[model samples]
Structures are given as C-alpha cells and as structure tokens.
Target: MLLILPLGISYLLRTDGIATDKYIDDRRNYIEQVLDTIDSSFSAYEQLIYTTVKITEELAPDKAEHEAALKLAFSSSRSALVYGIGIWYEPYSFDEKTERFGPYIHHIDSNNNKEEITYFWNTPEYNYQNREWYKTSLAAKEGEISVSPPFFDSDYTYITFGIPFSKEGKKTGVVTVDIVLPQLQGYLSDYNFSDFSGVYLTTKDNSIVFSKTDASNAAIEKHAMEGEQPGLFTDRTAVYDENEITSFFEGIGQKPEILTSETENGVFRIHAFLDRKAIFLNIIFRHSLQYLIFFLFWTSVLYLIIFNSSYLKRNYENRLLNTENERLTEEIFKRKEAESRLTFQAYYDEVSGLQNLNSFMEKEEALQPGNDNRSLIQVSLNNMKELSLILSSTIIDETLLAFTTRLKSVCPLETRLYRARGFSFFVVYDDQKTGSSQKLAEKLQNEFRFALRLGSRDIRLRAKIGLVYFKDAESLEQVLAMSQSAIAGLDVADSGRVGLFDHSVQEQKARHVVLDAAMSQPGFISELYMLYQYIVKTEDRSPAGFEALMRWKSSVLGSTVSPAEFIPMAEENGLIIGLGWFAIEEVLKAISGPLKNSGLFVTVNVSPIQFIELDFPDKLDNLLNQYAVDKNRLKLEITESSAAAAIESFWQIIDELIRRGYRLAIDDFGTGESSFHRLYSMAFDTLKIDRSFVTGLNLDERNQEICRSLMNIGKTMGSQIVAEGVETEEEHRVLREIGIKYSQGYLYARPQPLSETEFGKS
Candidate 1:
C-alpha cells in the first residue's frame, strides 16, 4: 500500500507539471497576437486620418469654400463616430487681422448628433497658433502626420490626430481630428477567469494596466484611474500604495506566474494563478485511486481532469483572440464609413445643400459629346467680401441663401444651378427655355432690383453676370473660363452689367494672350516706340499738333498688337507702370529731334496706373529734363474711363503734371460716366469726343445733338473739343460746322511710326 501511494503521487505530479508548462507557453503566444492586432489597428486608423486629409486638400482646398462638405466629412466618416474633426486656417484666408479662424468644425453635440460649426468674420478672437497640436505640427516636416496625448473632454476620453493644411501648395494650417477612447478600467470588465488562472495586460513601461479577476472576484482596482488619466502619477510608486500593491500576489494566494510581451512601446502581460485546491484534491484521491474495485474508474476520472484543464486553457486563449478580432472588425467598419462620407461630401456642399466645386468639375469631366442648346452664366455677388467685414456672417449666409432662392425662382425647370465657390454661382440651362442671354440677365437684374427683406434690414443686392454661348462638344473648362474672363473684362464702373462672350472680347483675348507672352521677351522693349498722327485744325485739313501713340509691332507675334488689346491688360497686371516708363524714355529719345524743329506739340497717352505710383512724377520729370523738351509741347492724354477713379485720389499727380506745363486731355470723353463732373472739376487741355458719337454725327440727330452739347461743355470749361474717329470728309465738315477746335482719326493721317511721320508733311 505504501509503495502504491508513492507511485500514484509520482504519476500525478509528473502529468500536472507537463500540462502546466505546455499551457503556459500557449497563453503567452495568444497574448502576443492580441497585442499585435491592437498595434496594427492603431496604425490603420492613423492611415485613415491621412486619407481624409489628402481628400480634403484635393476637393475643398479651402474650408471656407465648401464648408458644408468639410463638415459632412466628419459627420459621414466612420471616424466621426470615434472622433470630431476641425479645420484651422491662416489669418489671410478669412481676412481676419488678429485671430486665426477655424472655419469648419464637425463635432458631436451633447445629444450625440453630428453638428457643424462655421466661423467666419464674426468668429471669436482665438489664437490657434498657441495651441499645443498647432505648435507641434508646425515644427514637424511638411506632410507628416502626428498623434496627440490622450485627454478628456465632455467626460469622453480623446486622442487627437494633427494633419497639415496647405494653400497655393504651401502649408498654412492643420486639421485636428480628435477620437474618443473606451474607458480603460471597464474595457475588460465582462471577461471571465477560471479558479486556476487569471489574465491581465500590462504596459512594458508600467504606464497602463488592465486585468481580469480570479474566482474570488478580486481585481486590480486602480489599474487605470485618475492616476493615469489626469496624469496624477509621476512614477510607478505614485500609481500604487506600499501595501495595496501586493494585492495581485495576496488576492491570488500565491506569487503569480507572470508572462509578458511588447506592444507599441508598452508591455502586455498575463498573470496566471496556481490551482492549490486541485492539487489538494489530487493528493487526497491518490491512495484511493489504486483500489481494486474502483481502479478503472479512478484512473479514467484522473485523466479526465488533466485533459479538461488543458481544454479550458485552449478555449480561454481562443476567446481572448476572438474578442480582439471582433473589436478590430467594428473599428474597420467605422473607418470605412468615414472614408465614404468624405468622398460623398467631395461631390456635395453641406452648408448650402448644393453641388460643390468638385462636383461641378466631375460633371464637367463626364459630359458626353453631343449637340445641346445651352448657355452658361456665371453670377458674382459684387462686394461680398467687403460686406462680410461690415455685416455678421449669419447675415451674409442668409443673404446668400436668399439669393439662391431668387435664382431658383426665376430659372427654368431644366436648368441646374450650383454654388461654385464663395459668392459665385454657376447656372446651366436649356436654350429653349432661357431665350437669349440678354433677356436672362435683365430678368436676373430685375429680380434683384427689389430689396431682400431680412427682418429690420432691407438688404439690396447687386451682381455682375458673365454669359457664354456654348457650342457643340465644347469642354466645360473652356466655356466656364471664357464666361468668367468676360465678366472680369468689364470696366469697374460697369458693375451690374452683363458682359457677354463677344467677337471683340475673343479677339482681344487672343491678342492679350499674345501680348502677355511677348511683353516678357527681350525684343518687347525695343518694339515699343511712338507713332505720330495729325491732330488737325478743324476748318482746314492741316496738322496743328501731333498725338504720340505707343504701338507694338512684334516679330514673334507676326502682327500689330493693338492698344485696344494689350493696354488694359498692362494696366491690370501692373505692367503698365513699366510700359509707361518705357514709353516716356522712348518718346523722349525719338521726338527730341522732331520737337526741336516744328514746335509742333506731341501728346502721349498715359495710363491712370502711372499716377498712383509715387515715382511717376519723378520718372516723367527725369525723362523730360534729360531730353530738354518743352513739357507744353508734350501733351498727356488721359482716357475718360481711366480718369474717373483718378479724379479723386490722383489729383495731386494731375496737379503736379499740370503745374509742370504738361497738357492733360480727356481721351474718349463722352463715353465715360461722370465725364461732366470731371469736365467741371478738373483743369484739362482737351475733351476728345468718344468715337461712338463721332461715327454717325452727320446721319443721326442724336449723334449731332450729343456732339453739339459736348462742344458747348468744352467751350464753357475753356477746353478744346477734338473729334476722333473721323473717317469721311463729310464727318470732318460736320465737326468743322460744329466749331470743333481739332480732329484726329484716319481722316488726316493714320498714326505712323516716326519713320513714316512725314507722309502728310511731304
């Protein structure tokens, strides 16, 4: 009996040890897999953040442009369920002087509904430059992604992803995406542990800890509390008390079998407890197991317990792994939802409930080749940005929405209207319903002529429309660009006017493109020289003086670049300032010989742009002094359209020129608005009648009346009346009958270069 007992004891101990060793290894391998999955899932989420940012920059570029869509990016994203996204912009984007703007903020409110917050002119003063993530990201390399430390807001734990924002291909801001994390302590609360073992995950650096309980219901009470969250702990000691720290060993009734693995700079460890009761049961039954009556039964029962423990160990490991996979699957699903929303918002504008710029581009790309009767109209609300400064953003948004309503009310059933960007709206229509562009523009104007009643404020609206007639199979970009460019070509005073795509503008654009490219060439400067034309005395066909006209005969262009083509372009691009300097220099060098001989004054046209330049007077003074030419003999023609704006602020320059004995003529006088105001207020050498009234002076009574009235105004103002564009002898005779002082056109002589200036003289 004694020998039997010893043999049985040896058998049981040997089997238990072997099984324990095998199961321990299996548990550890299982834990390593769980940790790897978590690390990979985190990396996947980070990639999702990058994807959202890239799409935003591609589609919206500027948040203020497609604000609704940006907010929808958060609301539609699976990430939004986990986190909120906000866009922070540079100061100049929204035109704020002191405070930076976060124009679109997509966040879950207290009710858990996704809400959008738009910040524009009325956004409160907050310096986003001082934010932690903002500073951190600015120091990071361009296009690099980063993660912020976990924090709590609205009782939800969060970690933020900071991404760079770019404008004009330069990084200017950051997109902050904040995600909510599950409460650390409660994450594993439902996990079940056997009497023989407990499982727990611990960080390698001892920063985070989570644990499952044993049969006693004892657990790690302070594994992840305020000590880890609010950062109340400095080191390991701060996380645990001297006696309570021993609870893991004390609660399990023995030193634990600890297993550890690494995860994202942290450790994931499991603590398994030894089953002393099972050991005691095995010992108590050892002597009885070998009895003759119960020998087979006892042996079968013993083997059963041994294999059952192994079974339980395997099942437990599988359960933990399953839990991890399920959680990761849920996260992946949410992330996909987020990505889909971003793509959808890519095509939709969330704020105004209209198609965005990206949608327009996509539609444009998708259009089929077919003959369709269509007219494209681009409407711009003039002074919208200025209005934002004066009125609240709420008011501006209301006005914009109201404007859309007005457009919808007047537009055809087949027409599609899209809010392009900012205050610009694009309308596409069937020509069968739209009639003519002029009628459409007039209808739109009349619709806006009445004030929009917004509570106590009756806000008036003013818009400039550009119309382009489309041809078969024309690309959307071509038509859209043509329409917008036509609008841009309108004179500043012509606001509320519809500029249609016309043959003249098309020719001008073709020449403008040619001139723009050629002006930068080395030959452009040498090609710029003055042509002299006769400013004839009215009674007899004789030259009284000469008007010096700057002409471009480009070798590369293979044609004469008209003043009508490149002059306005030069004024707009600030190239006219340089052109003015070049003209002054060349005219002085050319006419120094001519002026010395005839005492026949030469009038050179100067752009209004030159007067605004502080150095204009100095440049002109230096040119004249250098050549020693009389300033009176060098008259300066100021186009009436150019003089309208100049009459107020440019008077000092005008006075300086006049005081210096330089003559100033109002070129194309009667065609401009406020010509009479200029004629009455400013001192001038001549008021040249615009060519429109001059062409039909002998035929139309209205033209004759206008010419007579302008001559009387010139006489009263002590200014000379010069009739331009005189084509026939009859036109010249009528101008002479009206007592006009001077005339110039193709009548006496066309403007000929200094090489050909003596054609009429001979």
Candidate 2:
C-alpha cells in the first residue's frame, strides 16, 4: 500500500498537468471566438439601421404621406430586433401644435399603426420634445448618432439609437432604433464564447443593460438610466469605480475570469466571465473515467492487504488462547531433554542420546589438532524406508531407541556417538579406546546377536558399518563423505561386513566431479556418439538388430568416460535431456542417410526424464516426419525402474509414441525388481535381460533357473526375450539352450560407431 499510494498520486498529478496543457488554450480561444460572434451580430444591426435611415430619407417628406417611413420601420421589425424603429422630428417641424412627426413603432401589436396614424393622438409622455433621442439628435451633427438612457417597460428595458437625418443645410429630423432587452439576451445565447456560468452586456456608461447574472437589481437599473458617478449618464464608463467592478464580480459568485471586449471604440463593452471553478470542473469532467479506473486499482490492492492483516491478527489471538498446546509442547521438550545427558546435548539426537550429524561433524573437526589415531564408523540401517511403510511411527521410534542403547553399550564409554539421519548413525573413537577396524567389527557383530523385545515382538535390526581411519590427511567432512559412499554400496547380506573407504572410491568420486564439470561446457553434446551393438537371433545366430549405446570421449578429460559412469551422472544432473536428444537426432540421421532401405532396425536408449517430458512426443514426431524414417526401424529402450514410478504418465507417453508408429522395449529388465509384472501389465514389444543374469547363467544354478523362468514368462507375455552381455559361446550356448530369442555382447561384435558399422555386415 505504501508503495502503491505514491505511484497513484504521481499518476494523478501527471494527468492534471496533461489536462491543463491540453485545455487552457482552448478556453482562451473560445472566449475570443465568442466575442467575435457577438461583434458580428451587433454589426448587422448597425448596417440595418443605416440602410433604414437612407431609405426613410428618400421617402416623400410632405404631410400627405408618412406611410413610406412607417413601412420602412415595419421592414426593420421583421428581425425581432428592437422594440421598434421610429422617426422623431425636431419640435414643431410639421406645425406649431406638433412637437414630433411620428414614432411609427413596429412592435408585436403594431399592425394597427395605420389606424393610429389616421386618428393620431399624442400624449405628453409619448411626446418627442422630452425624449432623449429627439433632443440629443436635434443638437447632433448630420452624421452623428445618439443613445437614450435605457428605460423599463412591463416586459423589457431598452435603450434607443438615433441618427440625425437632414434637409438641405438643416437638421430636420432624427431616426431612432430601440433594441429589446430580453430579445437581445436571447440572441447572445447562441454565441457561447467561454466556460463562464453567466454572461451580460453593459452600456458605455458602465450600466448593465442585459445580464444573465442579475436582471432585477434596482441599482443596476438606476445605473442604466441615471448613471453611477453623477447619478445620471451625462456620458461613458470612466465613472465606473472599483466598488462597481467588485459588485459585478460578486454577483457572478467569484472573480470570474471576466473577459471584456469593446465594440464601439471603447463605448459599449461585451463581457464574457469564465469562472475559475468552471475551468477546473471542466478538467475534472474530462478525466473522470481515468480517475475512476485508478481508484478501483488502488482500492483492490489496499483491500487485500487489510484483509490479510486482519486474518493474521485473528489467527494470532486464537493461537494465544490455546493454553493446552503450550503444556503439551513443554512436556515434549522435557522428554527430549531426558534422553541425552551431556553438556552439548542440544546438538545430539532427541530420540537416541547420540550427537546429531552437525555435532558429529564438529567433533571430527575438533579432533584435527594434536589428533591421536581416529576412526569414524558410519552404520547404515538398510531397510528403514521399507519398514516405515509397515510400522507405526511410535513403534519405529521406540525400536530405534532400543537399537541405539545396544550400540552405546558395545562402544567404549569415552567415545562419542551421532545420528547422521533416520537410517544412518556415526561413531567417533580414538586409537586409545579401539584397537583396529577388524576388532571393532567383531564387537559390533557380537552385539547384534541379541534381539530387542518391543511390545512382545523380537525385532532384529541389521546394519552395515563403513570404517575410516584418519590422521588429518583429509578434512573430517571429506572422510565422512567417503565413508557414506562406501556404506551406500555395501549390502547387509554380503561378506564384507565392515567396508573400508579406499583409494578406488576417491578416484571414482574425482571422475564424477570431472564429468559433472565437463557436461556444462559447450560442445559437450558433440563428444557423445552412438555405438551400435548387434543383437543376434538364437534361431540362427544371425543379425537381428543393434542396440545404440552412448559413448563419450571427453575433450576436457583427454580420455573416454565409461557409459556406466557418465550415463547415470548425466541423468542425475539433468543434462541427459539434451544428451538424449542429440543421440536420437544422430540415429535418425543415420537411418535417413546410409542406413536407408537396409531393412534393419536400431534400438536407442532414452533417459527416464526425457521419456516423461511433455514436449517429447511432439519433438519426436517432427523429427521422424522430417527424416522420413519408418517407425518400425527405430525402437526406444526404457528402464524398468522409471516406468514403474510414474505408471500413468509413462503409459500415456508410450501410447502416443506407438500411435505415431514407434516401438517400445524394457531395457535392463532384471536389474530392478524384475518380477515380470510390468511386462504383463504395461505395453512393451520386447524385454531385454540385464547383463548380470546373463553373465552367471552357466555358473550359478539360480541364474540358470531365473533365465529359464524369464524366457517362459517373456514368451507368455508375447515379448521377445533378449539376453545382454553374451561374451563367450559357453554362456551364449546356455542362453540358447534356455530358448532366449536374442543375444548381444562382445562375442558377436563390440559396439562400433556408425562410420564403422555396415548395415547388413553384422
């Protein structure tokens, strides 16, 4: 929320800046355009008045006909302009009894003007002698114009425009024009010039004649008729003081951005007031949608934070209220404390009173200075993972405690013990307490003879111990690491009861490190090439097909890495996906080039990871379609261990692969729990016997029986049984006698690269 708030504020401020930039000029220009429009509208009235004055003067001035002048007035009234057009003469111009000739008003009811003129009666109020236009224009020069003080009627208040019309060398009469106040305002409505909320027009005397702001104010009316400074309009706006301007602005609600333009050479002024609030309001209106979107965005973000914080607060309070849980936790801690009695007991195992893996490592490191002869023994419990599936956690924990108690009694009292993991334990003893690894092994084996009784069950725990003797030649971590590797390979049923970590194990580990580093470099995949090993049918010892084995001659190592060493390394490090794809492409290329039309098929090894990949199916399909290779000629060998792990996913992948026209085989079948169960349950075209069983077929009776049984099972499952590692004819003869369908090994031919392999030569 803190981060989001600043960002949103900056965005809104940026929007405001952009809005101002885009709209300010538009507002100013709008005012100018509006003023120009009003100026143009008034210009038309000035032209009409001048044209009417000329036409009226051309009319016959005799007493017999005033109808022509009145007719001109009626034509001017067609525009709904002023109250009416009138001609007011100088007093007694027509006769001694007459003050004015006629003011032939062309108002809404002025159709009966002919009758009024025929029986004309002049009231004193309607007399032209007292009128402002008559007296002003009588004194005005021939071309001069005069304006009367605006007067009020029931519906309108207006001022009159007068021009002096003359006979030869005399000012005989005046032409007057009265513009209606309400009608003038209505005309101004179409000329929108600014964002002002109100508009009005004022006279040259600073008196407002027409206003949308306040039309009923007596002061403004008085100012229109009588003026402000002299209390009457002797002339112009020079008398308008600050108080009047202030009052004008106050009436509009604020100091409106009032733009005043002059139309009569600074006599009459047009005002367009653009309120400041209206400008901002317009800006807000323009950006309201964007503001709404940002509002929802910030609201959602803040709501999530507030909701999560509230949930956490309630959860914390609920936890605090559980007093019973605190008591149980304290009891568990006390029970764990009572199991180990030592100053450094915190570093020891909670279930068994032995030091933990961290403490064991610390103790081994501590013994480096002034170190006497030291031997670290690592004991591995072989079947704890299997037992965990069958036994309850409580029984397993109790069984482990009893086993550790037995181990402690057999060991020297001064020695320190440690539990490395759930299934592995560590013991550190110096030469002062133990004689040799052989004597220690015997003592450990002797202790194993007695079984512990746990809940009426005699549970015998079997373990393998890996021994390491040290004198600071290597770091304790390295020594313990070597011991763990040794223990991983040992079997509880083997004669090498206490395996010793040796030089061969270190060399293997070094080779593994070298291969791991080399696999990460460029062109590592180029180092890998396939060697085709021939498989012969037992029926005639003829070429059946070849299995593609991956071989590597690493440039960095300056030697070849055995497939046995680098293959598993690649699989574990996730480099096998790339390496496996490289092999597949090379094999397909071979089939597309020299091996085309050979009628012989080749088998390739695929890693479990690549087989289960989601994109693998599409990749293989594209490659096969591109190469135009027949599906029958390429078979993929899959490991049994991986197939059983993800049965459903593997089945789908295999089904798709076969549907696209390919074959499947189970490679190294006998290596991992070869019960022939998957051979019957899962889809497979062939079952390749592991090399281990084939190597011992002639020597071991059990190997001989297992092969015969596998062959029978393979035939029943309708899959051809292939025997690998057929190095000698004697072993091959035994496999041939066992009714094996195929055999592959060095006795037939060693694996050769594609360059050396002739398709039918095998």
Candidate 3:
C-alpha cells in the first residue's frame, strides 16, 4: 500500500503540472487574441485620424466646406468608436482675419441618445492650444501619431490620439480624436475567458485605459486618492516589492494569476488575470474521479483487485474512445458548417440576404426547356450613391433589406427575387398570366410612394423599373442589356416611372453604343473641332469676345453629332477630360495665331469634371505658356450648376486660376438652384444668363424679372453680364434696358469655324 501510494501521488502531481501549464498557455493565447483585436481597433482609429488630416489639409482654406467635410468624415461607425474630435489650428492660420479658429465636435448623451455638438473651443476658459494633448501633438514629428495619457473628463475616462497636419509643407494644426475608456472596457470584456477572469487595457505609463472588475477600479481609485499616479497599484509596486503586492491582493480574497502582454508599438499593454482560488477549485474538480479510482483500487487490493483491475482498464479505455468520438464529430460538423457557409456566401447577397446574380443566373439556366414565358423586371434604387454619401452604411444596408422585404411582400407567390447589384434587384415572374408583368411593375412603383424608415430618418426612395419579356430567341445577357436600355430611356426627372423594352429604346441604345465607340477611337480627338460665337456689346452690337463651342464630326458614324447628344455621353465615359484639354489648346491656338491682333478675348466652356482636377491650374498654365496667348484673352466659362456643386478644392483651384491672371465666367446662370452667397464668394469676371430666360425675355414678364435679378446680381459683383440666346432686336433692346453689358446669341452671329471667320481671313 505504501509503495503504491507514492507512485499514485507522483502520477497525480505530473498530471496536475501538465494541466496547469496547458491552462496558462491557453489563457496566454486568449490574451494574444485580445491584443490583436485591440491593435486592429487602434489601427482603424489611426487611419481615421490620418483621413481627417488629409481632408482638413485639402479643404482648410474654406471654413464652411472644411467644417462640413470634417463632420462627414465621421460616419456612424466611426462616430460610435470615438467620443469626440477636435481640429485645432495655429493662431491666425485657418483664417488670417481671426486670432483663433478651433472647431470641436463632441458627443453628448441626450435623452439616452448620442448627439454630436459642434462648438469653437478657442474661448478664453477652454483654450485648446494650451492643452497637453495639443502641445504634445504639435511637438510630434511629421507623419507620426501621438497618443495622450488616459485622462478623466466629467464622469467618463478618455484617451486622445493626435496627429499634426500640414499645408504647403508647413504644420498648420493638430487634429485629435478622443476614445472613451468605458467603451473600450466593454469591448475588452467580451474577450474574457470566464467570469472569474478579468481583462485590462493599460497604457505604457501603467495608466489603466480599461479594467473589467469593480475591485480593480476601486483599487486604482484608492491609489489615485493616495497621491500616486492614476494606474494599477500592483503594477506600480511590483517592481520594488512583489511580495507586498501579492499580500495586498491576497488580503482582498484575490490571489490572481496574471499574464501580461505589450502591443507592437508599446503604446498599450494587455493584462489578463485569473483568480488562483478558482483555478485550484477547477483542478480539484477535474481530477476528483481519478483520485477516487486510485483510492478504491488500492483499498480493495487483496480480493477485489483482480476483478477491479479489468473494470478500471475498461473504464479508462471507454473514456478515451468517447473523447475521440466527440473530437471527430466536432471536426466533421465544423467542415460541413464551413462548406454550407461558403455555398450560402456564393449564392446570396450578404447585405440584403437575397439570392445573388449568380444564383439568379443558375436558376434561370435550370428552368424547364419550354419555360419561355418568364418576364424580368429590374427595380433600381436611383439615389443609392447619393444616399451613401450622407447616410451610414448600416442605414444603407438596413434600407436595402427593408426594400427587399417590401418587394417580397408585393411579389407574387413562386416569383423569384434576386439582388443583381448593390443598387438594383431583379424580379423574375411568369408573363403569360395576362398583364402580370405590368401589374408587378405598377406594384413596385407604388411601393416607393411610401417612405422607408432608415435609422432616425424616413426617406422616400426613388426607383426606376424596367420590364422585359424574355424571348426564347434572346440570351439572358441580351435581355439584361435591353432592360438596362429601357431604364436609360426613361427621364431621370420622372421618378418611380416604369418603362418597357421597345424598338425605340433599342434604337437609342444602339445609337449611343455607336457614338461611344466612335468617341473612344484614338483619332477621335483629331476629328473634333471648335467654332467661335461672337459675344458683343448689347448696346453697340460690337464684338467684345468670342465663346468657343466644341463640335464633333465622327468619321466612323459618317455624321455630325450634336453637342447636346454627345457631350453628356463624353462626360459619362470620362472622355470629356481629353475633349476639354483639346478645346482649351485649340482656343488658345486661335487666339495666339488668328486672333492675336483681333483684340477679342475667347471664352471656352469647362466641364465640372475638368475644373475639379488637381492639376487643372498647372495644365492650363502649360497650355497658356505653350501657345504664348495672353491670359486676359482666354476666359474659362464654368456652368452655374458646376459652380454651385463646387467643393472646397474647387474654390482653391479657382483661386489658383485667378492668381495666374485667368478670367472666369459663370455661364448658364438662372438655370439651376443659384445661391447668392456662392456667387458673392466666388471671383468670377462674368455671369452669362441662360438662353431659357433670354429667349422670350421681351414678351414674358417672369422671364424679364429673372433676367433682371440675375443682371442685378452680376452688376453688384462688378461682373460683366451677358444674355445668351438673343435672337431678335427686341430681345437685345430689352436686355440692354435691363442693365446687361454683353450679349451672345444668333442675333449677333452664328457659331462659325474660326478659320473661316473674318478675323482668321485677315
């Protein structure tokens, strides 16, 4: 008995030792996973800070634009991660007229909802420039992000991440994003291995960013109250007296087994703590059966040993078999689960949870050979991209799901719905059921009449439905193309409209394809030319300048394409940039060669896409220098709609052009939602009233008033006013009486080839 006892004891000790090592190793692995999650979260935050800096640097010169842009930078997902964000500029840097301009947007809990409030933090009592975070951020090297020590704000604890931003190679300001400690605490707590285990995120300075236990919080608070720094008492004292710290934890009924890990950047540390008492209890419970078996075998060694020996051996073998079976069962289940997940992902749209395009195609291909009566209706959300700009991705996803649900509710039973793309869906149903397709289209249109509740906002979505009856002769790709063409034929202004694939839509689509193909050819640029129309003084009918209009005569089509038809197509296909550059260079060449001594300034219309290019100013400068044309003789005309849609960088580009001595004009005024503030803020030299208001200005009172108002605005801004589309003497006389200075229309002269004009002949 005595010899057997020592052997059993040795075996038990070895088993317990192995189990303890494995347990600690598993906990350490869990800590590593938690650290990885923390690192990823912080990396995202750092990326957000970098994005904010880039956006601020680009839009800094415009106050309203940059502020709105900064606000937009924080989407719902990002906003939820951060407590607040602040943009602090050096004194008089943002605005030379003011000594300070610091915009701080902070989240506040209002009625149990989080609301963001924007306020200038440059006030006397709360000068952000004097704060430690700001000072440290400013001292940081270029491109380096600095993290502030954990600090308390009101009842909440937070840590600030700061990055310095520069403009034109000089540091201008510091941008900071604040993270709430409790939010991080909740995040880390989710990774706790058990209720008895605690997770903590701490800074390099030992300041606790987050701790899962009330006891840890109380201990940190006690240490803080005792004039020690706000950090873990055990961590601070362990270096000097480890035994004292162990005794302190033991006194509190917590002999903790702690595992510590540092982050890659060493900015933060992760500490995992498990109660020693709980570990001891778990070890005892796990081995209690083995201890009992050993005791029983040894106590009955004389008579029962022979019988019990086989019983014990069989029991051990059965346990091993059960464990192996469970492991194999779990692995098989996991593999099957993985395969099912992959199949679902491939066949379904993750956002809407609807069958995807691949699934739809497969279903369509597998249809019975005689099933030729299926009709496809594409329901498209028109403003999804626009909505994405202002709404959260979560809201957009929810809206899409709700749209699918609503669609399914209206769809006929047995009809299949598929999400063809992000902003569109396909509804395939039987068209043989007499007007079924028409009825379904009507139902889909009616569904959009009601608003969908997306987060806090209720928005009515606009959809365009295109219907196509599947023909046995047409392939699925051909049918899809026809449906898209049908949708394209419907006017965008006619929201919620349904259109059917017809001969006219097909002709238009074919014509568009031909034109696009012609425009894509390398020699298409050479085939393009320009015509100049006279912009004359309204009073004297004498030429002040010429407006350059682009003309396209495609050799491939063997016909001249109208500007209205091909210009928008060019813009859509990104060919406008090339066309715009060609027009600018051609106009300059005409000015420098044919009209050098003509003393007429020529204005060329610029597309919004071209005007927004970062290198637009440089490209224009190069063209101007290459042609040796006077900058004053080349005026750039930007449409009012384009001007209204201009962002902060647009204004910056405009300033660059003005500084280079180029004159700018706002063409087609009164044709869009014209803002007085925008016009007043811009540095335009001319405002050309659109032909719509000028065509009947002599007869229509409303038209006259609009023209007069536009003229008054132009005159007030010291800009030359020109009336477009003037066709008669009466219209010209009225425009003259309305204080117009310049006029460009058929009444003066039609657009003619610059080489055939009288100036070119001279």
lDDT of 2 by residue, 197-238 (tens): 445466665566544442235645554554433222222213
Looking at model 2, how many pairs of residues clash? 1
**CA shift of 569, model 2, Å:** 2.1
Give the alpha carbon lDDT tens digit for every residue of 1-762 in model 1. Answer: 335545765776666666666666766676667667656645645555565565445433344434643554554454423456666665555453344446646554533454667664323465667767667655656666655554555555555667786667777677767655443333333233444344444433232344443433223334334232212122211222213433444443554455556666332333334444444444445434333223433444455566777776566556645755785697689789999899878877655667777777777543444665677788887656546545877998888887788788898767777887667888776676657656877678667768888889888766778887667326777777787776777754676577877767777677677778887787776787777888889888777788788888888888878888778877644478778877776667666875567667777788875775655677788888889887777777888876765423366578777777778888888777755654576679888899899896789889988999999998888888888999988888888888888898997888786666663343
Each model's lDDT: 0.65, 0.68, 0.76
lDDT for model 1 = 0.65
Candidate 2 to truth, TM: 0.38
How many residue-pair clashes does candidate 3 contain? 0
**Range of the 10 consecutive residues with the lowest summed lDDT in candidate 1:** 229-238
Clashes of 1: 9
> Which candidate number would show the highest lDDT if scored against the true structure?
3
TM-score of candidate 1 versus the correct structure, residues matched by position? 0.41
Q: For model 2, state the Cα shift of residue 505 in Å.
A: 6.2
Positional deviation of residue 18's Cα in model 3 after best superposition, in angstroms? 1.2
lDDT of 3: 0.76
TM-score of 3: 0.46
Q: What is the C-alpha RMSD of each candidate to the true structure, in Å?
A: 20.8, 44.6, 13.3
lDDT of 1 at 170: 77
Index of the highest-TM-score prediction: 3
